[model samples]
Target: MLVEIPIIQKMVLYFGNPSLTFSIILFSILLSSGLGSLISGNKYVKRFTDNSYYYLLFTAITILIIGFSLNKIIEITNDYVMMQKMVIGFLIILPMGILMGIPFPTGISKLKNIYKEEDILPLMWGANGIFSVIGSLLAVALSIKFGFNSTIYIGAMIYLFLLFYIGVFL
Candidate 1:
């Protein structure tokens, strides 16, 4: 989200104000992720087993590809009206949001299987929340120093690290 927020902000700036861009991007990600989570029930996740790692890899690849192409996307839609650009931005983000949603539920499912303790679920969620806040703050600092593109690349690298962790450690 830290990475995505800036990308969306940059894209939406071509058509709208900063506040509107922020609201739309945030709302789109939340709504899409919520839907993705709802769809990723235990049964859906259980079918994957270790194959979930591949999903994470694919998600990371997708993020990198999208991040690389974001400028082109903005250029392609530069002539679009605000409503059109908003819709395009939502469309562009929805897939990444869905992919982002998968890891949490999948990780929880794995943890549940390993620990056999439902209690740990909340701890995982809390840790995730804390890390996300820290990441967002870090992203802001990074963006200030390196610009949004580099910040996004950093986020992509983090995803790559996640893929490596899942591949080697999990």
Candidate 2:
């Protein structure tokens, strides 16, 4: 969304165009991630069968869609109406961020389910933060090699692989 912002602005900035394409995309990016948390929580898990089992699965697929369609979205969007499409893309990227957010809280939930302890949640969160930082660094490096499209695809693939690992082992 960041890279797409200026491109979107340059796509012909129309006056009084309430729909800022780049802004919509950025907002959607945030909104999607926040929603992913609730979507990936235990409440939804119990209500929806096999949902909990596909954390990495959803993340992978979502990222891939974002990768392949991003350029298309940019090229096709008109200045004034572009915001709408950008917002719609939120629906696509939401699962990616939301699913990513899931582990932050859900991991605590799962750990508590197994160990029945509250104190461990903090420790788990700290560890989760550290690894997130590390993973982000790796993502940046990968993005340089693959470009945005393949980067998203590869991220999705790796996320799906993590799911496979969890499914197979734990």
Candidate 3:
């Protein structure tokens, strides 16, 4: 599903080291996940808005831009690796990861306001786990059926569903 991922392949292409490419990718993912967790409790930053519209708007725009740029970013950065790949991945995913994290805290706010108990967190987290597994399964299925290039496009389409649900419905 990573036919559109340049930095990794570029690492492989330039240095021709698969291990380095894999390490670069894992580093990026770990860093982004850490960055995501760091801001997980700060969603109320949008309280300046009268409602959640501003946050939702930002999320939609960010996701849309990221989705569109996924291909072009790969194209443009088709010659980076090692430290270059590390910098590129952080530059790309840092803001996206932060904004994507806002929903978790915002969700906590919503749950607190709507419900009166604490037991729901476990169930909600469990459901999230299931959703993630399903998402991975879908990615594998798409890659199997259409190969990697089309799978990246399919992932973009999947992000649009998130935009529709959270961006519009929120």
For each candidate in turn, the TM-score is 0.87, 0.68, 0.66
Model 1 agreement with the true structure over 17-49: per-residue lDDT tens digits: 878887888888998787667767767654653
Q: In terms of lDDT, which candidate is stronger, 1 or 3?
A: 1
Rank candidates, TM-score, best first.
Answer: 1, 2, 3
**Candidate 1: pairs in clash:** none
Assess each prediction's global lDDT (C-alpha) against the native: 0.77, 0.56, 0.58
Higher-scoring candidate on lDDT, 1 or 2: 1
Q: Residue 109, candidate 1: how far off, in angstroms?
A: 2.3
Compared with the true structure, what per-residue lDDT tens digits does model 2 show for residues 19-47?
Answer: 65446555755675566566665665535
Relative to the true structure, candidate 3 reaches a TM of: 0.66
Which window of 10 residues has the lowest lDDT sum in candidate 3? 1-10
List the lowest-lDDT window of 10 residues for candidate 2. 1-10
lDDT of 3 by residue, 47-109 (tens): 522245555566556655665675577667767655675577566666656655556655766
Model 3 RMSD in Å is 4.4
